[model samples]
Target: MMETSKGNTSPLKVQLVYTTNIQDPNVYSEVQEQRESPAPPKTSAAAQLDELMAHLSEMQATVAVKADISKRHLPDKQDHEASLDSMLGGLEQELQDLGIATVPKGHCASCRKPIAGKMIHALGQSWHPEHFVCTHCKEEIGPSPFFERSGLAYCPKDYHQLFSPRCAYCAAPILDKVLTAMNQTWHPEHFFCSHCGEVFGEEGFHEKDKKPYCRKDFLAMFSPKCGGCNLPVLENYLSAMDNVWHPECFVCGDCFSSFSTGSFFELDGRPFCELHYHHRRGTLCYGCGQPITGRCISAMGHRFHPEHFVCAFCLTQLSKGIFREQNDKTYCQSCFNKLFSL
Candidate 1:
């Protein structure tokens, strides 16, 4: 019997204890006494304690789960923070290159636009923080607050012109050149022929010899391509207003002789007509690299290949001797002293 708080029962009652028969009179009497005392019985103590322990375990488990969730989310937060730092570092370098004396506070100087948080360039030299000016321009310098983004300081004027000296390449007294940035300069006449080092004044295409270089050179000298013609001359290419010659094409522009038919050579950066350039290896005296083939000297005398050495004093044929090894300048002992005296 439990008491009802609905104004319908007494405060003291025996809950879960009923009077069956008059079997256990002593037990019945004890229940009645406990109802009078209005307290729980001794047998119910362990049950109440067990219920409390169950509630405590549930609370502990809930807290442990919450802690685990926080631990899992921490690394994601750290990664986001790292990405922000990297972005900021890159912007700082750009600001330095612009030669900005100070960091802009709000609006852009050149475009006169509001700078958003994401698009705000740290490189600008003019900006406004307190006022919403549609344009950023230099006014009277007021005693206002300033800040340095990288090494640059800013107040309110355009400081892009305060950077460095002009570029040496295209900064000319003439008006044809254009300066893209304060540093990058270029001339308007840069697209002419790269071979003759000639500034092509007209718009006509030109070619010479069999190695077509230019029309001017072909008529002046005998025209014909090199022994190794049109082969994307990697070492050099054709050049010449006097005649057609590969940049690497060492055919004589005067004699129509091939000089470097299958070898390497620097483009002479000059006008080489077809008949003048000569490239002859077998006929050339290997000693001084002069022609001696059909004229007389055998290829195997105290024969010095172009790559061999000869003594200046006695004309002694010297192999790769100790003294000849350096630049292969083979000098007899006497010639060495005579040359070194100077």
Candidate 2:
């Protein structure tokens, strides 16, 4: 008879019975055996390497599948972020168009108060519509034309009064038309000669000391007059003896010769060249009877050359000291005493 038993710890169990024919048939021997299943043959290193390679190939395929999935979805993620940014930008623009953007609150430049509701932007500042007014007149000005000067706003009337060109003569503002002369502005009707107080025509005029004058008035009032011709010296005049004269008129009073470029002398407000002056006014020497053109000595209404005036008897030059006169002749005091004294 044979029997088998199996359990969790033991893999296989077998019981065997054997009968001896020579002995007692009835007597039987029992044998029991337990055996575990044998393990398979040890594998080679090459086989182990091949198995590792197969596992690695499977892992690589799985990683490649994950990468492909990520690559396909990356564009969608970026597009979603970009769309969110664009939507935010559109919302901002819409807010601005509706005047609800997060703009900083401004203050009125004129009143220095917080500006609310409607505002006027000008002169690099913000102001309430009603607060922006003309600085000069202190009147509200907006939507209408205005002017600015020195960082202050003004209306047209006040602007013109404060800044417009003025007449040089009257010192009044010239609004409509202006005439510029002598580096100054004037009203057309006010542009006139300062001397005659007459308005200048299209003809030429002159300026002196920043005052305008007509040609005729300028010549008569300011031009130098020739002493000889008694006419206004237009040009090419000579100045002598504190008087001005035309070149042709400046001649010798005696010879009437032009002293255009020569030395002259003035006698009784008349010009005389050197030759004529000397010849006409030269005194005759009493001793030599010749014209005393050089240094001379005069005594008793008579002129004598310095070298010729000598003592009558001694014949010495009478250079200094008092001399005596007799019969229209001069003698030294010593000679006179020697000749007359007893």
lDDT of 1 by residue, 1-342 (tens): 332222222232223322222221111111123335554553554465445446546755655565556556656866644544444444445434432122323455545644332221223233333331212244422223232334444432333233322334434333334434223343535423334544444544344321223344433343354343533322345544444445445454344445554432223543233222223223444566554334333433333443445675667755435343224445766667777756
Q: Indicate the worst ten consecutive residues by lDDT in candidate 2.
A: 19-28
**Candidate 2 per-residue C-alpha lDDT over 62-157 given as tens digits, one digit per residue, 9 for 90 to 100:** 655655565666568776555544544554464344333333247778767554345566666667768878887888765356666776777778
Pick by TM-score: which candidate is best? 2
**Model 2: residues >4 Å from true position, as ranges?**
1-133, 140-145, 148-153, 201-204, 259-265, 273-342
lDDT of each: 0.39, 0.68
Query: Clash pairs of candidate 2?
Result: none
For lDDT, the strongest prediction is: 2
